[model samples]
Structure formats: structure tokens, C-alpha cells
Target: MNRKLICYLLSSLLLLLNCNKVMSASWEITYPRTSSDSDKSTDYPLKVLALALEQTGVNFQLIPSEKHYTQGKNLSRLKDNREINVVWSMTDRQREKDLLPIRIPIYKGLIGWRLFLIREDMADRFKYIQKVDHLLKLSPIQGRDWPDTKILQANSFNVVTNINHSALGPMLSNAQGDFFPRSMLEIWDEIETLQTDNKLIIQDSLGLQYPAAMYFFVNNQNRPLAHLIRTGLEKAVANGKFDKLFNQTYQSYIDRTKLKKRKFYRLKNTFLPSETPLDRKELWFKPN
Candidate 1:
């Protein structure tokens, strides 16, 4: 072949290869690891998700999000820059907005958690929040500021928002706050190590349950890649790779005994009477 003809052929082949090359997909796992020593180990769960893709012969990259960008805006920026292709866990409206949910759920949240936490000494003062009007009568309950504020505000729950769970104990102990209502698991996790003095108690009497589901959120524009991830996860689950991953990454967290180390007492507030007299007018009042 002539030299010029050979050059033209090479260029065409290069263009074709570039066009056919599979785009690299990556993920940023947002949850924090247990500690600095365990940072690299945190990548294992995401690698499990990646291993599933590998089984399907799908070549992609898995990148764990830096612990510094744990949640909210910082995490959003990592996705905006295309630094990561997926967020490991996110909830409902979040899944609908910025990302697409593939068929397989990386994890499922507990159906719902509604536990009211109180200073151990003050459990008798405030009980489950039954009537919306009754809650309003009780002033200054303790709650976390972020989602709690929005959730409480929407439901018209009368409560004061505290930035951290740690603050609630001292505030309630000092009589500055009423019952601290929040997700059962959240408060339970916080009080696990701090329960040495019988300082805190979690009461699941409010009956306010929030269901949170975990999903892999891919950017909206990357729907095709999301489908690939779905296919990979489906195959993984069928082949038992998913179960192996769950055991390896999460068995410790799911242990009921370990999870229940701190007693989460279910205190029935005076409002919830176990036995109602047959003819009590208030108990039998029917909505007209």
C-alpha cells in the first residue's frame, strides 16, 4: 500500500476503536467507615457491587468517596464533577431526582423506625406523641435539625431542633427539653457507648415511622449505564455473590445482640392506656 493510504487506514481504525471502547463506570460510597484504620476496608462493599459487574464481563471502575465528603453538598459536588458514577445509598425522592435506580437494591432500610429517646430519669414526663394537638401542648421536645426539622414541621409536631443527639441528653437532663423523638436506629447507634450511667433511654411509642430504602443512584444522564449495573446486580444475586457480600461487609452491623447492646426501652406513655373501661366516653368517642 502507498504510505498515505496506510496512514489513512491507521487513523480510521483508531477512530473506530475509540468509538467502540466501553466507557468506564465508577462509584463513590458515601457512608463513613467505622474509623480511619478501616477506611480501605470500607471499599469492600462497593467492590462487592463491582465484583457482580465483573462477573458479567462488564469492565468498570470502582472509586470510594473520600470520607471528607460524607453527605449533602460536598457529596453532590463529587457527582457533579463526574468524579464518581454512582452513589451507594440514597432514599426515595432522592432516587427520583438526581439519579436512576437500577433493578437491584444494594440494601433495604428497616421498614420504619419511630423511637422516642429521653433522659433515663425523665421517661415518665413525656410519652408517645398520640394526638397532634396533645404534642402541641407539650413544649420543646428534642429533635435533630436536618431531616427531623422538615419531618416535624410538615407534621406540625411541636418540638425544638437540636443539631446533634449528644446535645439532647444534657438538655433533657437539665430540664431544658422534653422527649427526644427520632429514628430508632439513629438514636440507638448514638447512645450505644454512652449508656454507661443509665443516662439515656429510647422509647418507641410515638408510632411515627419513616421508611427509608437504600439504592444505587446513577446520574440521570447515565441511565444506560444504570441498566448495565442492574443487570450485573441481578446476576450477582442469583449466583449467591450478593449474599456473600452482605455477610462480608455487614454481618457485624446486623447482629441483633450487638445492635441491642443498649437497652431501647418501649415506654408506654400515660396517654396509651393498656386497658380501657367499656363505657369511658373519651376512649370510645367516635368521630361524627
Candidate 2:
């Protein structure tokens, strides 16, 4: 072959190899996972994440961390970019400072609309408690590292906390806490998955209302990934795919709550950051 032709062919081959490498490269996104068979809370958020990535037309792989960590540990790992690259969590002032938040409420604020899981025997006592003050006298079980624990404590609601997420149910059934305040989106699945034989019933008469946002957080330095995710999520929201998936996942549970019939006591979410998009009514769920 002529020298010029050989040089051209070699350059073409290198270009082809570089193109292949670019095509094969994908973002490796890691998220926390637990061994509990009943914990399906991550299902919807993970789906939303997948949807957002799809919208961005980005090549990415979603991975569950091999090591199970509590919510706090997962956030810490994400902040350090240690194992997990992304974490979905309730936003607080400090959390936003530690990580880049997408600022979209993945649960549409449903995470703050809480219902109580009380021992079946305590049903009558809860039924008569019409005032927030009366209910504040009862203790609620929460994860030690959960934002809800601090929110409850800030609101003067006695909170019993355990580091283990799975232990909260048993604590409620064992009377270690007077009641377990769970998100309406989570209570039904949790009740069905309760391994204990002790009867725990949803306290139907009253609910707690606060303004909270569950956001997808990435390492502070991962601005490109953060921007991509936010762009994809905004696209999903504008296209109505976000609300559709959200409804398909939690509509039945919302119906079961009959929130219209329940009187809700409003509490100030002191942890909620001032920058939360409270003006975006389209991004929140308001029970009629």
C-alpha cells in the first residue's frame, strides 16, 4: 500500500475506535438498597429516576449498592461520592448544603402527609383525639437518622427513634412507641409487609400535614450529572409522565386514606429549606 493510504487507514481505524468507546461509555449510578423483602418504598423513586434518564437520552446504568446502609449512611456515602452516586431523600437545609439537590419533590409532598400506625387496641384512644395537642402527647416511632424524627421533635411531638429501619414496626407493636407516623404512600404497603402478628391499625381520624420535599441528591461536585437529572426531570414533569407514574403507583393508597374525611393538624417544617419551590403548585399534591 502507498504510505499516504496507510496513514489515512490508520487514522480512520483510530477514529472508529474512539467513536466506539464514546458509544460504550455510560454513567454508573448507584443507589442504596436494603435486604428487607417488604421495603418497596424505593420502587417509585427508582422508576422516576429511570424515566428521567430516558428523557435525557443519556447512557446510564442504575445499580443497587451491595452493602445495605441506613438512610443516614447512604446520604453520607453520597456526599463523599464513596459508593452511592445518587440518593432520594427528604430535603432539609443541611442536606441541600452537603449535596446538589434536583429541587423536585419526587413524592409531590406526600412524604409530609403522615398517618399514624397504632396498635389495634389503641384505636379507640386515637379516635377521640381531635386536637393536635392531645395527639402530641403520644409518641411516634421513627428512624434515628430520618428527617421526620427531627421534624416531629421540633413540632413537640414525642418521638421514639431506632437506627434500624426495620425495627420501627416491632417497636410500635411492642408499645415502645405509642404510634408510628408513616407517610400515606408507605403505610399500606408497610402494613401488608409487617412480619409481626400483632395487629397495627391506621389511626383514621386524624393526620399530620407539613411541607416537605423529597429530592434527588448528588455529590456537590457532580454538576453535570445534577444538571442532566434536573433537565430530564423537568422534561418529564412538563410532558406529564411524572404525574402519570406517580398516580399509577400511589393513587390506590391515596384513595384508601380518604384524606378528605380526616382532619389534619398543620405543623411547621422548620427543616424545610427556604428555596423549596412552594410556588409551583403543579409539583405538589393537594387533597380536595
Candidate 3:
């Protein structure tokens, strides 16, 4: 028996054993788990992904983060060994070395650098970001170890990568750094809560605009299965099921009474929770 041939055969067999014509064994969604009410893992994106997968005749076991997903012992395994097959809502470039990006985009958003805020008083020092080169020369800036940092570096912004976004708040509050760049949606609440007097502000600066955004990633080793999953997602979107899922997940976040503040698009389609919603009573720790 040829040793190289034997190894290839074993790898093929393992892939076959793990995934069937219908589905893969299970998937891991890498995200931060915290005490915040928004930390409910069973919410929107996961449900959208799972519903999309099921519609394509695929069945997946949703794996929740015991601790913060990105900061836990599990992420080390995911990074070093490529053990996690599928990760929901991951910025692509940072994990491309170890993880493969699905071609189909799960969501769309503008990816760019936003200025950190301590209070409204210091708004003078930090004005709008006009150029990437100008931002690089400033004091240390912080970001999570994801594609956001890569975008910053690509635009010539010197960034200090941290384990979590929460860590950057203290650094900025203590006057240690100039600003922290982060995804606007993910850190909106955290910034307002962490900054004293509830006076956190983000500068209007567009660093990068990624038109077709992704909300998840899969391990490079499972490239074949990942492609199939993406195809199912596209089908779901085309058939309107994905839109239903998106509305359901996004509705809880948007305040309906604040119609005057919302844009025309958001106001048009009021979101609704899934009909056959997964029992996430176990996942929610806070009172509704």
C-alpha cells in the first residue's frame, strides 16, 4: 500500500463519514458570549442559517458558545486545527489562512473604520477621518482579530488587535489610545453603555465598503460541504424564505414605535419572529 495514497483515501473516507447527501454532522458559530441581553445565541442569524439549511434538505446541529466563542479554548482549536466546520457571522480575511470563505454572501453591510469616543468634549481632537494614511500616524487604535483589522491595515491604519471589543473601551477610557475601530452594528450598544455619561460617539469616516457581506465562515478543510451550504442559502434568498428569516431576526432589534427615526426601507417591512421558532428558553439568561 502506498503511504500517500493511503492517507488520501483515509481523508476522503472521513469526509464522507461526516457528511451525508443531506447534511454535515454539526456546525460551530464563533461569537462572543457575555452577560448582555443581546448575547442570546439563538436569535436571528443562526436561525436564518439553520432555516436556510433545512429548506435545502440539510439538517445541522446548532452548536452554541459555552463562553465567549472567539475568546474561548474552542477558538484555539478552530484556528490551529481547523476543527470547527462552519462558523456563523465571521469576517473573512482574518480566518482565510485557516478557514475557507463561502462564495455566497449571507448578508450585506458597509465594512469600514469608525472613530472611538470617550465623550462629546474630546470631539475636537477626533474629527472625521479623511484618509487612511492620516489615521496610521495617530495613537494606538484597537480592533478584534478579524477582517476589520485587515481592512484597517490595507488602508494604512496601524491597529492593535485585541481578544474582545470590550477590552478597547477601557483602553480608550483610560486615555491610552486615540480611537478603536469596530463594526458599527456589533458595538453600538456596548459603546453607549461603557462610555460614562452615555456620551459615546463614532466619527463619520468610510474606510472600506464591502458590497456583498458575509455573516458566516466554514473551515477550509470542509470546502466541499461549505459550497453546498452556500448554494442552499442562495436558494433560500431567491425563494423568499431567507427574507422571512431576516425580518424575523431583525424585527426584535428595531424599535417599532420609533418610526419617525427609521429609514423608509426598514419601515416598509415590519419583522416577525419565526413561526416554528426554536425553543431558546435555555439560551436566554435575562428576563424578557
Best TM-score among the predictions, by candidate number: 2
Candidate 2 matches the true fold with a TM-score of 0.91
TM-score comparison, 1 vs 3, better candidate: 3
lDDT of 2 at 5: 100
Report lDDT (Cα) of residue 115, candidate 3. 26
lDDT for residue 7 in candidate 1, whole number 0-100: 100
lDDT (Cα, tens digit) per residue for candidate 3, span 1-288: 999999999999988877674364454444334446555443656676676667667555665445545533444555554345456543443444555655444433322213244445556654544554455676555556555555555555566667665667776656566666543334454554674423556543222232224445565666666766777777776787866765465444333213233121110111111221124222111112
Worst 10 residues of 2 by lDDT: 33-42
The sequence of per-residue lDDT tens digits that candidate 1 reaches over residues 110-223 is: 212345556777566555444556655554454343443454555555667565544656676566765666543344455564433347676434434443334566667776
- Which parts of model 2 are misplaced by more than 4 Å? 1-24
- Which pairs of residues have clashing backbones in candidate 2? none
lDDT tens readout by residue for model 2, 83-120: 89999999999999999999999999999999988899
Let me know the TM-score candidate 1 reaches against the reference structure: 0.54
Per-candidate Cα lDDT values, in order, are: 0.51, 0.90, 0.49
Off by over 4 Å in 3: 1-42, 67-76, 79-83, 89-94, 112-118, 127-137, 195-199, 204-212, 247-288
